[model samples]
Target: MVEDEFATEPFEVAWAGEARWFLQFLSEGAGEVSVRTQVSADGLVWVDHESPALSGPMRGVMTVPVSDFGHWLRLVVTPSSGDPSSLARVYLALKE
Candidate 1:
């Protein structure tokens, strides 16, 4: 189940040897939103795993592979034309 909440900061998840992850975003307002996947070994320093995973409308689902990723993963969101209140809910799931 997804614990619905607005994303005010980078949302992080611990890598538990999952082969893939799924991210879902639902927006309440109209705007351009960018969501990028980042990875870090120590969880202190992070690097972008790929190009902007999702951009444009803030509502969609993204699938991320963990083959070359670190032990930690996160989503860095950048929204234009809207504030943090524009985000309605976010969900993440893991697949082995």
Candidate 2:
């Protein structure tokens, strides 16, 4: 579902305890699009995990490993220059 215009809905880890996580994104559109991962401990204060996890003319798949993320995670997508009607799909998974 379309979570948000700038960010996805906060989601909890699938694992019960501390575990590694990865975010995969598949997008197709024109112009320049960028995506980054964010983490939050309380779900109220969020912070960017690393550099732009994925960036460019969204037209392929990209995977980014998330480390040091708190208990919640989300995605932030930005369009540097592109049709405002562009869209992207995101997927999240975890491994213990």
Candidate 3:
């Protein structure tokens, strides 16, 4: 089902040199779901990363990489703009 805008919990990754987000869409309804990588310092507030926003189609997957971020990271997912409905998963990969 299409969901309202949401954000993942702030994750502390100050030790990692790089991070990757894997967005997999298992099923979709209408348009598509867009994802934005966000960064935070205190893990209480957030702002978007410099990379462009991304979206995935039904049964498709999209990946985004981020670096130069501070101590915290998260993803803000939105289902507006005539976009998707349900069944999407997110994964984060960090490397030194």
TM-score of each: 0.60, 0.71, 0.86
lDDT of each model, Cα atoms only?
0.54, 0.63, 0.81
What residue runs in model 2 are displaced by over 4 Å at the alpha carbon?
A: 1-5, 14-27, 51-53
Model 3, 1-96: lDDT tens per residue?
Answer: 337888988899999999999877777556666789999879987889888888755447778999898789999887755546667788899998
Q: Could you tell me which 10 consecutive residues in candidate 1 have the lowest summed lDDT?
A: 1-10
Highest TM-score: which candidate? Answer: 3
Clashes of each: 0, 0, 3
Span of 10 residues, lowest total lDDT, candidate 2:
16-25
Name the weakest run of 10 consecutive residues (lDDT summed) in model 3: 79-88
- Model 3 clashing residue pairs (backbone): 1-85, 32-83, 32-84
Better of 1 and 2 by TM-score: 2
Scored by Cα lDDT, where does model 2 land? 0.63
Write one digit per residue (lDDT tens) for candidate 2, span 1-96: 222348878888745344333323343555565678888887888998864566666555656667656578888876667553444566676655
lDDT score at residue 66, model 2, on the 0-100 scale:
71
lDDT of 3 at 71: 87
Q: How far is candidate 2 from the true structure (C-alpha RMSD, Å)?
A: 3.7
Q: In model 1, state the lDDT of residue 72.
A: 67
RMSD of each: 5.2, 3.7, 1.8
lDDT of 1: 0.54
